[model samples]
Target chain A: AQSVSQHNHHVILSEAASLELGCNYSYGGTVNLFWYVQYPGQHLQLLLKYFSGDPLVKGIKGFEAEFIKSKFSFNLRKPSVQWSDTAEYFCAVMDAAGNKLTFGGGTRVLVKP
Target chain B: EAGVAQSPRYKIIEKRQSVAFWCNPISGHATLYWYQQILGQGPKLLIQFQNNGVVDDSQLPKDRFSAERLKGVDSTLKIQPAKLEDSAVYLCASSLDSYTIYFGEGSWLTVV
Candidate 1:
């Protein structure tokens, strides 16, 4: 069975501080990776995704994720954080041949303005 | 385009009661998914349908949970005799050609 792990459970940062959320997955075969965000009282939305080619993927709202296959990691990062960035983030993975996603324990971020 | 649509934004029921949720996917999307999200955890995949055909449902609790997409457009998920642990947000999502899934405002269930 495939599983995802998010090392950070909760993170608090002041505005303009850098941000990084660790994500690791357990899978032996080809996989598709994704990062999703859920704002307070809002549905989950895609932040970024990695299917093939180019390990670094940029997404909406100044978010980016890098897929490092050798390390079995796809970490989300932002150069500077804003108060609007406060939300819960989740990392997900699925086998290349499958459509179902396996998500990790989410990380809740609180950005203080 | 319209994102996924779900009805009954919230539901409250006692243990051993029955509850159901409905979802309508985006137009032209072939894949629809149902997920259960606990208060502080990530969403867990419960079932997936590809145009009225089940693509995956390995994680669904079959003994009490049932779901169907009859016409490949709208879907329904039902829980018979729900448990306290079953209290969670039921999320409905859809994707075109199995890529870039979009989620709807979830149906929140509280099993007392």
Candidate 2:
């Protein structure tokens, strides 16, 4: 069974702190990676995605993720966090030929202003 | 471009009651998906449809749950005699292609 794992369950950081949420997938074959964020009372939205491209992919809202094939990881990162950045982040992966996504348990980030 | 739309932002029903959720995918999107998202967990794919045909439904609980995407544009998912564990957000998503999927504001269901 293919799965995605997010190492941190809850992360608390002060405003302006750097953020990194670890995400690893179990599949070894070609995969499409994605990071989605759900803010309080908002629907889930795409933060970034990685396909066949440069390992580093940048997305909206100052978010970025790196797809490291060797580690089977696609970790999301943000240099400076704001209180508005507090949200639950989910990492997801899908096989190259599949339309279904396997998502990891989400990481809840709280940024204290 | 309008995004995927879902009905009944929230619903509360007793165990054994029945409920249904409706979704309308983006115009011209061929792929539609239904996912169940429990609190503190990621969204789990329940079913997928390509146009009006079922592409994958391996995760759907066909015994008590059923879904249909009629006309390849709108869809409905229903649960009969809902269980307590059925309390979760039912998310509807659609994609033009396999890579760029978009999610709707999910229909939240609480079975007490």
Best by DockQ: 2
Tens-digit per-residue lDDT, B1-112, candidate 1: 8889998899999999999999999998889999999988999999999999999999999999999999899999999989999999999999886868999999999999
> Measured by TM-score, how close is model 1 to the native structure?
0.98
Cα error, residue A24 of model 2, in Å, equals 0.5
Stretches > 4 Å off in candidate 2: none
Q: Can you tell me which runs of candidate 1 are displaced by over 4 Å? A: none
TM-score of chain B of each: 0.98, 0.98
* Candidate 1 interface CA RMSD, Å: 1.1
Interface RMSD of each: 1.1, 1.0
**Consecutive 10-residue window with the lowest summed lDDT within model 2 chain A:** A93-102
Clashes of each: 0, 0
| Candidate 2 local lDDT, B22-105, one digit each (tens) | 999999999999999999899999999999999889999998999999999999999998999999999999998868898999
